[model samples]
Target: MKNYKSYIIGLIALVGALQSCVKDSYLEEVNPNAVSSDNYWSNLTESEENLTSVYGGLLNQYLWNSEVEALRSDLAFPRERTRPLNYGYEWHSQSFTNTISTHYFKSWNALYRVIWRANQVIDGLNGMDETFKSQERWTTQMAEARFMRGLMHFYAHSTYNHGEIIIRDKIPTSSEEFSKPLSTSEEAIEFFRTDLQFAYDNLPNTQTQKTRVSKGTAATVLGKSYLYTEEYDLAMPLLKDVIEGPYGYSLLTGDDVSLLFTHAGDYNAESILEINYTDQHARLIQTTDSWDEEAYTTRWARYTAPTNLGGGGTSYFVPTSWLTYEYSNEPVNPNDSRNYISGTNIAKSVPLRCAQMIAVVNDEESTYYNKTPGYEATTFSGTVFSHFKKLTNHDIVGHEDEVLSTSWASGKNMIVYRLADVYLMLAECLIQKNDIDGALGYINAIRNRWGLMLLGADDGTGTFNDVTYTKETLMDHLMYLERPLEIGLEGYAERANDLRRWGVTKQRFEALAAKEYNVVNYNYTKADGTTGKGSLIQEGPTVNVKTDVNTEFDDAAVNFIESVHAYLPLPTDEYLYNQEVN
Candidate 1:
């Protein structure tokens, strides 16, 4: 079994173990004596503690919420696709046989337990007296609870099983409530909308920390839910509220853009909702050497980073030619300005498929960037294989001494939702409404920040001209081209869900596996310690050496991919255990 202990972090040991949306009896309260069962949640301080646990649910990393999200999308290529632990990713990536693998059960169980806790928190807050806490504070806490409940509901709805999932607004203390029938698609979407509406109405305009939810956060999610359900008219106004709202959110500019990945930029202005991760010491409490709280830090850098670069990573997840060459286009200089070395250290280079791993720089040390033959890598296709740079702060990471294997846990805070995403979605909404000019304004806002040309700007590359865009044309660019490039491999599972909803599984993956595209501006240092830039690209790069590049799209995987339709099968265990799902 892949370790479920770490995945089940910060969960309180209730009377009955948390399972599905059905049990309120596990509401473990203080005063083991008979102080009356009804008044357990009588104070505000205790209610806040319950609220914190609901937020703690976001800390689990082993499930599909984090690294696996990237692995399943076209944005990332896992090193080992057939590994038992990776089945959730494989299933979503259109490769799994009709089987209930570990991933299927893990993701299903992890999220539902979260919903259970959210229900408990909502119930506790509702029963608490207003005199114990301020009317303002109590209501805000309730809004946050509803927000988590809604968000998890949406996540479960979109991530694994879609329409068949249940919605529990009230605390389920009865067996019938726990074993309720699966809801209809319309019912599930409305459940998501209802919770988000509650959150949007009561949440404050802004919060001191990005970890907390706000009106903009709720609005952003509500708008996305509306768009997903094809309620474009409703989505447009909510998106507009986020775009022009008083959330104080703005896209980071110039070299500051990399703050989205670095620890220095935690809770930066662009972040609307950021999941916080701390160091090993802060993430978990050590009661003894062998016994400790679960390490709730994110394992993203460990899976995505290059093993050679002190990250102890497999560097398994790389970018595709379709994403890098065919779709992630460049400015006219025969180079991707987005991926190139700008005059400053940081820019839009992170979204680039390939990355440079910089070594440590101290007074007594020789500060050198890694570019070894076998150690420094390239994929089989001959174009320089890309490595993800957003996972770490561009430093060497080693494992903790107690662990035999390398686990470079950087514990970086992940930005869940932000203003830039709002802008892009707004642009999409505008395109659907045939407001092309309004759409371009949002699109260009992202492009201009990264030092790329605005939509109408004449770069000699012939990338863009003064042609007017119809709904189909704008959507084609935005869907396949713009959004994929802008939001690739950021660890939100955003890209994969988009592909699943768009229904482009077979066509997209088949074309990606067919041929390799050239690596843009492949950079390396010579044996003499001199940097070299191999220019005039678009030739496929074949791997001249053995490295961690073991994944590919073979015939069986692709054929099965085309066979899949809208609903991903629920785990067989779900049917066995729940006794109510179809």
Candidate 2:
């Protein structure tokens, strides 16, 4: 696994330079003094440099991907009502107004920014000086650009922007071109798959910089597209191409599974694609907010860490009771090392965090924790129980003021695609084909590694016994039960997408709604191995406890969860300001 640290440094500079050039009109103005696009992207080397900006666009997308995609889904519950498009809170407007909407606008804008840059790179590539670089290099760069372009469209089409989105395959130089009519969903999905296939066939098996697109990266996207579309046969081989490819992808085992998230694992063998964020600050809280010194860092950690820990770091997201319960590993065994504090092999208490975090931070008998004995889950009442260690970095207790310790210090290379995710998708593809043994092989491999009882095997935990499954039951198990447990909270909206694909999005969320107003006391393990109590439901009277989403869960959730309303309504600006949509 290579970090390609130098490449990322150069990327930051290029992204900075590119972003500084504001567009006053649809056509970018060319400064006769500066390097213009006409003269700059005239060769393979230059075109490749331009491709870095596309990757920069991807880095920006990652800034808001989890909040916008995952939080609104069943995977996470937002503790605050800041964003219009967030789950588990009330909203000011049913129609997404500009004031309250941030995640939806930024996600849509950033991905399209990638598409915009990709189109520039692709158009420029046509005129690249072949003699400056190898034919293979030029083609590979083109493939990478196409993959980025298609990936942006695929997600934007499926995840947000429910209605038609303007498909920009080429750089738009005129105002007329920028405001074209929207394309249908069928057109978008097929367009997305076509671009991905071209890249899958052309990209190298491995690249010097693991962050760059490769054969495995392209295959995973193509396969995922098919999987979401329910094209079982088409999905299997493409997914298999990534599964058994020469890229050396393997699930992170033992401590490696936990380390899979730290900066040390940025380009590890398991990674297919990841948005690279350096120690540099990533974005301002908004265009109007004072410029943060830590431009390359994300505020995710600030939102996740509990208030008692240090900086009032505990408002944005709280682990749902559903997520907390899933880790209990109840049915298969009394404990499955994955939970927060009460497991045998892995003592588990809190609901959120990577498995190893529990092993390190709060272990059984309190040997490890008793020695440190700092602020523990004791402070977490109804508000914050599962302080998600995925981003919290529990290994280091203590922080400075509110602004996270020295900015960007929360620099953990977030995982976008990894080995376990690939394996589960492969299992899904195989199960659809009635390949039960083969599907179970992949699934059991993951289960066995995590100290979980195999499908039929039962340890001493009364929660376990033996059960058999037919095709439908297995599909149900994989989509609802297996995937949420394995891939939940890592990032993105896969859990929501999983439910949607299984045709259970509305039903599952509606079930969750029943518990919206209900309150629960925090029941956690103590340092001395005794069960201790914490705070009770603490939402003030201002909160509409019955509504489970940012806006009234009933209507806003319907727009977000329903299949036809899969895309969020276009930003308020789309119709009010953009001449095209109006």
Candidate 3:
């Protein structure tokens, strides 16, 4: 909960300076003019500082805060398909080529940089005196470092690369150590599991800084790794531990759910691990005009805010119509009075999460930017009628141009893992384990928070909405609906990863392409209890029929060759520089 962004800022600068001097290497370099490996690890303070640098990798906007990762998935796509936006959208169309390096190189390099930093801390700690190394502080920091190192490898190998990845477990001092061949998939998972196991065994339940990894964080991520590798039995108990552990993590409900992506929600009870970004941008801006002032902040808002609201023109990645329609299809919470328009039985017609996650031009009634009259979103991108409201200060900031009115680099922390994600994963595992009854509880907990209809009916009917519950049916709901609705547009390419792991990427896109999304004329009650009609895109007669089936979706469905597109290739420069790669 403490402000550690300043420490992250300094450590990032140190890591950059160290990396700049290293030629044709992936490991951290020892600079003759600066602190060297021989003297840097003398005390606990220095080791902890290096560990902070490991967490700084999460601040890589290209990886987390920006749309680079999300855009790779089906949840979002570039608002404009211009040449400048080619790399980001290429992942969708399966036209990926290493010639365009901005998205590919930055994200790949960022993951490895964290791995290198974690390796630096682990190596430095291993070199300390036996007496010092045996202390609680040393063990804890080592556990933290290994946790980070393992998580990065998980990202590089399992999440992004989807195959062999270099296992940089130690700092390379010689040329032989500098270049290593990629580890086999089996070897990579083994190394990943081992590192996370150590962290889980040694890390304490709590940390002085909440941003640092804890026992629950290790368990959640380690459990997720197991899920990715098809070790459902192994994943079940670990995820359960975090669910029923001493950690006080719980789901954020009601208004708090809407605030999850805003600055106020940073380090909240549901959050397991989050990257710390400083909220002192206003004060820092006054002191200097240099980049340091914005160094600790994230430009996520500047990139994700709607173009109408002054977001970057080149990278305007909005939520795809497929995603918005998916969220809209959630059964309205019939029991909640707020779901109904004032003095009428008519429901607002959009689900609670749809209102919270994206701005539907016509369906929403809430006061956007706190305007006098609600539902103020004027336009969206292309044929898409919704814009991503998550990770933007649209609601909190009292202005039409939220990103421009606020700091250039916003300070909202990016949450990597949370309790809701764990619940959904548990449901997934439970369904895989054939515990249909048990899985329903986990899935329904998420729905109950929003007062939406539960998956299964009461009285042990194993039915909801007159549909019988089966393992396949429940799995389909969790896989296609619950997971994307609850945690979409959050996490690190999780939607894309989920589709791949389920072996349904092409099928999912095909289904999305075939489906028709109706942009209906709807009505909502305004703040003053007056009726307001929203007909942003009126259809032919009664229903405005709009198929979200675009060229992007059509191309992705047909051209997404699993061998080539399922996994991102290692940056070309990596093979060029590393002799072992050839």
Candidate that would win on lDDT: 3
Please, what is the whole-model Cα lDDT of each candidate in the order they appear? Answer: 0.58, 0.58, 0.70
Worst 10 residues of 3 by lDDT: 535-544
TM-score comparison, 2 vs 3, better candidate: 3
Clashes of each: 7, 26, 1
Evaluated at residue 338, the lDDT of candidate 3 is 61
Give the TM-score comparing model 1 with the true structure, all chains together: 0.79
For 1-582, candidate 1 gives per-residue lDDT tens digits of 112232233344232226552223434433353222266587766566666666766665543345556655666555433342354346435565437445556666667666766777787777666684468888898888888888887877876556568676765555555666778777887897788899999999986545678999999999988877767899999988987789887888766765555667777778787767655434345322221113445556655554454333433455544554433244522233544445643333223222222211100111112232322332222333444555543433332222222345545566677777888888988887888889988987886666554565445665455556778887877778778777665434688677766776566666556654333232333334554433112436434322212234443235544335334567776565454763
Q: Model 3: residues >4 Å from true position, as ranges?
A: 5-13, 17-22, 25-30, 80-87, 279-282, 285-294, 338-346, 372-374, 380-382, 399-408, 458-464, 518-549
Model 2 lDDT, residue 391, Cα: 57
What does candidate 3's lDDT look like per residue over 1-582, in tens digits? 456654645454356522211345435444564434577888988877777767766666755525755776777777642222665577656677665656666667777777877888888898899988879999999999999888888887765556688888776676567678888988998998899999999999887678778999999999998998789999988999998998888888866776676666778889998777654643454432223422456666666665556566455676766676666667755677667877888787577777777776545556555652335645442354566776666666754344334445565566678899999999999898899889888988888777677766554533245456899998898887888878886767788788898999888878766655444333334445554334232222224224222444777788777787787777776676667875
**Per-candidate RMSD, Å:** 6.6, 5.7, 4.0
Per-candidate TM-score against the hidden true structure: 0.79, 0.81, 0.88
After TM-score superposition, what is the CA distance of residue 221 in candidate 2 from its true location, in Å?
0.6
lDDT for 576 in candidate 2 is: 49
